[model samples]
Target chain A: MNTKIENKLTPVRIIAFIFVALWLVIAMFPFIWTLWGSFKVQADFFSKADWLNAIFGFHTEKQTGGFFTMDGYYGSWIEEEFWRAVINTSIVVFFTVLISLTFGTLGGYALARSTYRYAFWILMAGLIFRAMPHMTLISGYLQPFFAWNVWGILPTTIIVLVAINQPFTLWMLHSFFLNIPKDLDESAMCDGCNRFQAFRYVIIPIMWPGVITTGLFSFLLAYNDFTVTSMLLSDENETMIPAIASFLGTVQEEGKVMYAVAAVVSATAPLFFFVLFFQRQIVSGLTAGAVKG
Target chain B: MKHSTFLLFSLPSLSVMFLFIAIPIVSVFIQSLHIEHKQVIIVTENCDPFGCETTTAVDTEASAKLKEKAPLGKFNGFKTYSNRMHFAFDEVGEAWKSSDSFTVFTKKLYNYPLYRALSFTLTYTFVVTPFVLFLGFLVAVGVNNLPKMFKGPTIFASLLPMIVTPLVGSLILFWMVDGDGVIGATLQKIFNDNSLSLKASPVLTWIMLMVYGIWHLMPFSFIVFYAGLQTVPQETIEAATIDGASKFQRIRHVVIPHLMPLAIFITLILLMDNFRVFEPIIGFRAEAHATSISWLIWNHLRESAYPLYNAAGATSMVTIFGVAILLLPVLIRTWRDFKEKNKG
Candidate 1:
């Protein structure tokens, strides 16, 4: 991957550089603008009078007596109680990742090790399940949940998220298991260890790299979800994504759109940190499937 | 592994899928077949100074009792499926008979809810998947040529759109394109049309959503293709170069063939992912102009006057069918590959 081929192609290199720079701006500008504007008042953030007003914070300075204001944050966090949704999201994400990974690891290991046609069929089935639009599945869950009186709770939502997450988690971890040498586990069993014992003592030690990658995705699925959590969970048990959406309805009428902008930034902050720290793992996790194919 | 051992390992995962995913699908089909019961009616005659009058009234007690006994309501067979909302078979038939051209018929058909959703869903999936692939490859190749130190930051920036919550990502863009927002206000000043609003037109709404789709989805294909670029063998490129291949020739003859498998892989994932486009619709608040099938089902369940379970279930059934159809080609290819592996 050296520049031998590209050395003579100076014109192409220039074009490539410009295109990449333009793309970087396209990718970076929205988040940058939103993050900066989240601190401004609605009038300045929107800035219908003049677009430059947004950057200068003209309305914000006039309204709040400062260039920056905590009014939106205070209004959303204290007045609207968005902190409760943040706590709910934290609990849901933690358990969903833990349970999804636990199930995915065991099942993935079994699928990878098995030399049966059923194994192939199971993986194929998981593929179909993965493609099922999660909203369609929510329609199916609502009725029975209502009948059983489990319709609006965090635990029910957790179990459903895990079920929805299982297919993907299984496929990802299954591929990881296939990458681990089969002889590693067979040698452990040669020492008189049973199947579970080999997995416990041998496989578990080396499985973290793959497990952590898979867990990050499971964390994402649970964290980014709006379909299941919004519908199934009662307002008291709502997650951050849904909370922001719910904010839009009331805040719009009250002429407090800044509160929603603040809430959106608040909800997105964790994910920003997530991508920042786990960028490498996330990239590898995404490419793992493509590489295998 | 022993069969029992495999079963033990997989049982927890299998049972949850069976309980939640599998059973609900069956329940949805059953629910789709049945519609809720209408209130029972009673007729009574009242004798008064004005003379005997006949009156019909809702039999509340009997209707409540009926509702209690069979909570799913009356057995309507496939009636719910054919009604105006889910799939208007009769309307399609009428449009077919009356319209002189296919376009005219489709224009008439878009008036129906299900067909309108299907039209947008199919268009979005087909349009977005290919554009993302092309632009993604360009970006990947561009990023590949970037200085080493800049690559990481570039990838981090690119991952933001794909990694952020789809709802939140769309909202970020939606606000930018709002009439009062920066881009929106600038456009108004530039065009000198204060009456201009992106939300006011159906075509603009569609374009806005598809553009959002491309923005959100491009990074995925970019990352995957960028990774694939790393594996392009230098020897092959050198071989092509020695044989007098142009840069374009080198890419076409060497790089593309190497990345063909990945292109197919991306196309499959992107089609499935984009086909279920729901979040952006919510994020853009574009339901007035466009609705996806997934959004349609969600609308039935949550955004209606009341939760229309049967309607929602019917749409779910259709959507599941669509997923199966989309999946068939890949499944067949995999099955063939598996058989070939076993035979050899």
Candidate 2:
């Protein structure tokens, strides 16, 4: 009846679109603020604080002539402590994912391929780790490790991450393994392949998607972990979050301008990093592999 | 043969879980039962009535000052639990002008120990769980129905808050919620004309927590629900539409019904998460408002004047067990539903 209707642009649809669009913006507010803060120059940030206050409902006052720079972002990135944290986080995440994936995927496959009487209990136990709070464990369960002279921060972080992340990976990977029909594994076994070979030749390729998703989930969690990192890590070697946190606090102490700048920088970098790579996987993997599993 | 292989394969995960999760919970269980005198309080009455302030000498309780310092030797079985329950139920009756006149009640309405902690915990879970789930469900539906291009971006944007450390989020929120900060200053200007002190109002004490908490929780619900929504079969919705059903009808009848399993799962997860909420409470209160159970636990552990750390830990275990028992019925129902649905 109407050209607009034919064009799939009805009033109802437009209103719905606008409503969703607003929601989306509100959802992205923290990230946007972080990004904006990251690029603002020190003096401009200070002067703009008042304006930002009015605009963002904070104590932002406008500077006479506001200009943007990348000083804070670059400074945070270049700091030796920041770099060490980056390196440490990377190393820890790598090992944690590797170890968790190997054991979780292997166990998941076993549960999928066979029907051990106690398989249900093991599956449920793995879930308990996923459900338990990391913070509670850090103070109680991890106290013994802190008491020990042998295990260092990096090792301890890895161990904790691996232990915590294992159950999630197991739950996820088990579903993945389950999706790959058992007839394939059985056929391989019939063809003179041992359990290991059958797993390697037949099941591994099929379950690769699940494995990748589990690894991705584990990696992200390990990389961004704050609780375990906070409890286990000392001030000498900072992680990404604590580094940003220190910057935010220091700026807060000095001036609100610097605080805004640090907030923007720290917030934007991780967000873009996540959006650029993990966005699709995070959603799809979460939907198919994470929730159900 | 496959069964044995499966058992062999499961052993590594089983061993790690047992050594880590099971053992620690057991140790915490054990720790809660045995109480030791970790705190020493100075009693003034015996020393001097005239110079009461300077007269008191600190001494440990005979029951608590044991050398072994193990839970087993410190208190009898169930003794620690009973004492904890007593402390939870019995609070110091009322402060008196003279310390000697005040009697810490043996049968208080609620003890400062577990009663306060439990109250905070139950309130936290009750408030957050329902709100998070409801908001999460709505946001998930909204996001799920978005155009393909916006879907990915929306998911990422929503999830960013969730991925950030709770402590960091708390700190940021703390700055914003402080009297001189953004939220306070803005509300002061707009509604009250620079008159409102958001923090000073007892009613508004937990407001920052509820508002800031949404930022963390919305993403979790969104992600979980989004995942769940993906599994809702298109045909079911189409069939409802073919019957001249409205969008609301289709969603209510078909979509929500399809998401029952997911709803159950997410409910359980969020229930657990809400129960343990700690960081924001700590960040918001900074040791002022008795906010949530985790904060209460931290308070007890951190109080230099009173070393009630064991008591706090014990109370936490009790809370944990209570939660497990509470959720057990829902979990059982969900499992049964899942099984019945799967079979059908």
Candidate 3:
């Protein structure tokens, strides 16, 4: 690649390195700070007297008799019953991703294969749905959900997330499906298989790469969600994000802000490992739509 | 695939979408035209030692019975849309008649919740979109120049902000910017004003939220643009260099044009996302200073019983209309592109 030679300009190369290094600090310092502070007491982390107390754990040592402490984590996980929220989030994310991918692959396959103009209209409608704010959709569901007595539960939230996620999932998978040669499935259909057989046997196997990528995004949407789950789910069915929000409401009055801090860090740890393992797939998924166009 | 087969394949998704997405929009419209039911009142006569007294008491059972029968409340016929909380016809009319200067009138207009939220949403969308585009392009260019060994780690670190939950990410930064937190404390010492608070000042609050937005969003654009950069035609770059073009000139003339389509793609996404702008307001506790359309709907329904469903529905409908308008340009452009491709 000529990019190898393109950076030969010494001054420009140095400038670019400095700029990127500066950006690296801005992007990472908060995460590093939070992850470290989650172990310390509130006084050390939020020390007004001296900021360096956080690094040295001056107040933390005085209060907890150790340089590092797990009081925040213990408070969030045990005292606050955050494990219930974690279990809820796991159930929600697992089902939401499963259903979204199943629906997305099928619908996206149809959209990708069809030559009819109506397929274009379907995608256009999906585009509009994709752009509509999730809150607006939540407002729509509240009254009917209330009347139906399905307003707050894990299953209802999962299905709603699946439906809300469908448009974006459809769009992404449609692009990925387009790249998979149409010839592959058509030939399978010609040989002996019916359409469903051809899809199940031929397309499904090769589609895992795209499906996995799409599934990760679905996981992120379902996991990162606050608007839908917060409004829709009852307190007993609280997911991680909403649970962290509630912790802020109650814990602040009792001088237990560190519980919220620990909960946030706890929720973020899985996402960190997720990105580490699937960084390439995530990047590919983000660029898929752009590259197609 | 045959027509029957196509139907079988698309059936599950189509049905779920129609039931969940399509029906609810119609329901939101119906809900917007109605108000919550008033408590049923019944007059009862009670005998006391002195005299018989008449009292009107709320009939709780009858009200619950009425609500069960007609849960959407009483039909108000667009009164909610015109109320002070929403479009605010009477308030706007009063402001229109009372203010002398156009500036004062404009100031008075945003005092309404709808306009107040709209102003912040539009400003945030317009401001953050451009900054993200510029900074993303900068990072993409910068990262592209770095040594190969450093590239992977750089990208991994960059993805942290964007990949984390938006609410959690904002909370992380919000704690740090609290009056006694690290950045907040440092700034206080530097300015010699211990009383300084980022949350207290509306301007600083807006800037901080936008900064958080940019921090969370820039990575998406950066990664997209980074991918776009790899495809820039090296021959053209070499040709530009042979023609005595400087690095900046080469980038301006060559790299930018090559990535223009990706830029457009990023812009469409950025606009859609920035317009919502909900979580950070809640996460930063900045509702007093800023609100978006999404935040407005959330506010109305945030109460225990969602008694303000009419207000929430009206705002949701208006927001859906806003999204439609926002999407119009992209749709037209895509339609033209499709038509051109078909004609050929």
Candidate 4:
């Protein structure tokens, strides 16, 4: 009986394992392609021998130089334009999350705690904004959003992102705030802790998980958002998505055949890093529950 | 103890939000109506070698000029609308008999491209949204029911799709479905045929899109469904099991009912979004057979397609109205539900 059970279970396990392994490969194709292409030299970029020979499951020696190198990746790392975008993306993402989470949490708490007359209206308004089409908003403000400024167009872009993210963050944070029990607040109040103190001391500590959840979601939303950011930030020295897009545009304009490699590499770099950093949070977020709330 | 301090703490965030989002949204509505009225100035005597027609105001000086030379004209509000009418519609019955290159009604206010786009938008939204929710639910349920060790890792692994930028996602899909990519090459080799392009062929293009769309969106559904599952009352499940209900029965009857509200919520959001799909279409236009409503608007707005703009805008407006119409009932129900939750 035991042997029969073992034999049956083993095949199921193997099949499940293989299914997961294939999914991982499919999911990470962009990252894999980027890593491979980012390291190649200019000359070897179009070598049919490089891509074709590998396709046929055969190995061929390079004619002059090789397929992989540290040069391009390292070159891009030190490239002033790439670094400036890296700094710009990071700053915008960080501040947007910080500002949105602080307000979202407070506003969420107010809505969650209050049994007031207009609480439902407040929540509905938040939901409507959350569901509003981003294109509608951006199209309306295209010129003004990117108006050239002395401090550079970076601040305006960041503000645009913050607005885009706030509605969703508010909705997510409100659910988390409601999950934290009301008794904890009442007890803290009885103990002479004021509302702010209760929020800071009692409620926030328990709501840490919710805060982190909303914060990470906000970061990803801001980080990967392309159209709004692309339209809102026209300056070359501003951020990653538009910078890479313009690079692709210029490559096409120059009539270069080897531009595909750069396009693949620049696009997948952030995705690779995101997978590495927030793997845990992302997993939980995915499997947590439905969005009915 | 300190109500003033609480108010002060809340004010900053509210003001910032109002400044960035609320104010700008209102401004956009105002700016959409730019320069409602204008004047066209035509000079006959001083006309240079180059054709130069300037649009100024039809004021006192222009009125005197108009009396002297009737050729110098000024067109008004409905005049522009009338001029654009011929481009707006083709009356098929009359054109079929006349055969004069399909003379359209210049006085007509209808924008045909926008009309076509609205129907397409509704179709796209209605189709894509539900599938996303269903697939997401299945994946989430599958992941949740796994052994605890696999649960954590599987959830993280799925995030790969969500983490990648859609621009990059479109790029990767573009390559994979192209002639030289691994999947396409493998398909060609396996089938013993050379003519296999995953994205270029009309039938295959749709298959590629559906697959890519599912891959891009499944993770979002999985997360939300998973979170919803976490709230499932464990004791009730245990009671059902004790009463000899099959695992499938428990899920179908108890769990699905529990998840209904969430499914409805997700469906509304996804429906709104999928109807407005544009990014992937723009990225992979060479391969995609599908052209969404937003893409139609953008394509028309390009300088090459300049004459098509008013029609496209009209189409977009119609689409916006269509979505509102479809979602209006659900919006009302959700509002009532939210109010009841607060009340009860």
Top model by TM-score, which number?
1
Of candidate 4 chain B, the 10-residue stretch with the lowest lDDT total is B77-86
Pick the DockQ winner. 1
For model 1, how does the per-residue alpha-carbon lDDT over A1-293 read when each residue is reduced to its tens digit?
45675455688889999999999999989999999999999999998888788888998899889999989999999899999999999999999999999999999999999999999999998999999999999998887788899988999999999999999999999999999999999999999999999999999999999999999999999999999999999999999999998888888899999899999999888888999999999999999999779
**Interface RMSD to the true structure, each candidate:** 1.0, 3.5, 1.1, 4.2
Best by lDDT: 1
Where model 1 places Cα greater than 4 Å from the true spot, the runs are: A1-9, B52-57
Of candidate 1 chain B, the 10-residue stretch with the lowest lDDT total is B142-151
**Model 3 misplacement above 4 A:** A1-9, B43-54, B304-306
How do the residues B1-344 of candidate 4 rate in per-residue lDDT, one tens digit apiece? 24454444445555656666666556444443222222335544445678666554447665565534632123232222223322223443343445544334221212333434444455556656777788677766665554557766666667777677666677666655556554566677778777767666755765565566668776777677877888889999989989999867998988999988888767776776676666666555532356566665456433242223333333344444556676788778887876787799
How far is each candidate from the true structure, as Cα RMSD in Å?
A: 1.6, 6.2, 1.9, 6.7
Cα-based TM-score, every candidate: 0.98, 0.80, 0.97, 0.77
Superposed model 4: Cα runs more than 4 Å off: A1-25, A37-64, A70-80, A143-152, A183-207, A253-267, A286-293, B1-10, B35-112, B115-120, B141-147, B185-207, B226-251, B286-289, B296-323, B338-344
In Å, residue B218's CA in model 4 sits off its true spot by 1.0
Write one digit per residue (lDDT tens) for candidate 3, span B1-344. 56677777788888888888888888888889999999999999999899999999999999999998888899999899999888899999999899998999989987899999998999999999999999999999999888878789988999999999999999999999999899999999999998999999999999999999999999999999999999999899989999999989999999999999999999999999999999999899998999999999998988546458889899999988988888999999989988998899
TM-score of 4: 0.77
Task: Quote the TM-score that chain A achieves in each candidate.
Answer: 0.97, 0.83, 0.97, 0.80
Clashes of each: 0, 14, 0, 14
How far out, in Å, is residue B43 in model 3?
4.9
